[model samples]
Target: MIHTDVTEPQDFLVALGGNMPSEAGAPGDTLQAALAALAEAGADIRAVSAFYATPCFPAGAGPDYVNAAARIGAAMTPEAFLALLHRIEARFGRERVRRWGQRTLDLDLVACGDAVLPDADTFAAWRDLDPAAQMERAPETLVLPHPRLQDRAFVLVPLNDVAPEWRHPVLGRTVSEMLDALPAKSRAEVLRLP
Candidate 1:
């Protein structure tokens, strides 16, 4: 039997973080507004983690950031979903002017089910990127499971709330496992807001 509909609706993981304020007023507000935008843009949001207050990347690039994670079921291709996210970010005045720069909004496509975007080898290349190279380089294409998710307490801590059981398609580690693996000081940094 030819399986014409082999693909299931995938729940995509999204990681939202921002340090700068937009017209929305504050970093947390921007994250809330972005979630609403995602819902309006055809994403069937299944879950959202509580807002988190985390220090900015690179120590002092800007103010501390608000972070959160969401799981949404979307039927579109990953690229299209990413475009939608970028459009929403642009709507909030996000600019691609700098890598990991302070932004009004940042929506990252963290993962989608068990799919290894681009490919495993490429993903591995990014996953194993050196710290200096990571600071200086950004991938030209989408990388599935977000190459750095495993090591980021800011991302994994929020993700633990929404998808603690979700396993890495390549690494086979669950969100909670990854979160637990981080240093105590690192995990302690992601403080959830009321």
Candidate 2:
């Protein structure tokens, strides 16, 4: 297991996503409340991307999703921070019924200050896993700089808004660069939420 030395108040990138309604209201409103919850939970929110409307990943799994990204400073270990995110999801009534299923809120820890949890080799293997394999299983451990980030326009596009220069620890590509590398259609699918 590999671990990076973490400094106090490390920066973290969190991906926000949801398609279902909750006590907090619509998906976009739920995301806004989630951000506020993060701040209440001791996350010093540095930046947040504008909300984007993205089609459901499975092409009909559920309603369109509201997606965004936020940069935050936190004084907690990666694992602990992830736990906090999960707790917030639970608060918003998220369920783990199916992979990539609809949800009221989904907060994914995208990156933590260039910190590579577990190890680089494991991260690479997961990052390169075939799409079919991805559908069959999820990573057992957290993968920093999120393994599939570069391939998802929903993530990269919103990340570009807040952290255009944030470099992927392993890929070494900036968010804007990754966003530009995506096919035009993938980019076009992420429309700003009105």
Candidate 3:
């Protein structure tokens, strides 16, 4: 059910990451293959940031991850687009066994145009959620602009390459601002892969 003809073709920001290797090859190779899959499956990928090598989130979830970001455009709704991302993850052997666990691939729908998904209050609830709570609970529904997008250096450092000027609909901060907001050490940990 890919949206071929539609009235709303929204801009999309996607965060890509993986620590575990898939059948495609190494984590970086898998990410490259996944981007190709997105294009073949109908995403109008506009730009992709450089790959980064980041320490495993949670300190010891697994090995380090290869992370990147992509700005794309598609005619599908956010929900439909998320489903497509999940399907692509599945193809890469992604498993949802636990939150923040190591994975073969992760294709997160970071934002959809300026849309505040579900609603402002609901988005705020997750957006303002604490890190401890974030590890213990996962939202049952999608939140636009991704609640934790502004907080993760690994996410923003790579995202800077593709969309530094893209502003957060709720936070009123650009990607560059968020990246700068992160502690210097946090940003330093996300080293660009040559």
> Which structure among the candidates has the greatest TM-score?
3
Tens digits of per-residue lDDT for model 1 on 1-194?
11112255567899999999899879888988998888787678899999999999989898999999999887777777788889999999899897888999999999988889899999999999999899789999988979999999999999999999999989889999988899999999999899
Better-scoring candidate (TM-score), 1 or 2: 2
> Which 10-residue window in model 3 sums to the lowest lDDT?
1-10
* Better by lDDT, candidate 3 or 2: 3
| Tens digit per residue, CA lDDT, model 2, 1-194 | 11223557888999999999999999999999999998887678999999999999979999999999999888888888888899899999999999899999999999988888779999999989999888889988888878999999999999998899988888888999999999999999999976
CA RMSD per model (angstroms): 3.8, 3.4, 1.3
The lDDT, on a scale of 0 to 1, for candidate 2 is 0.90
Q: Residue by residue across 43-154, what tens digits does model 3's lDDT show?
A: 8889999999999989977999999999988898888889899999999999999999999999999998888988999999998889899988988888897998998998
lDDT of each: 0.89, 0.90, 0.91
Number of the candidate with higher lDDT, 1 or 3: 3
Candidate 3 stretches with Cα past 4 Å from truth are none
Model 2 spans > 4 angstroms off: 1-7
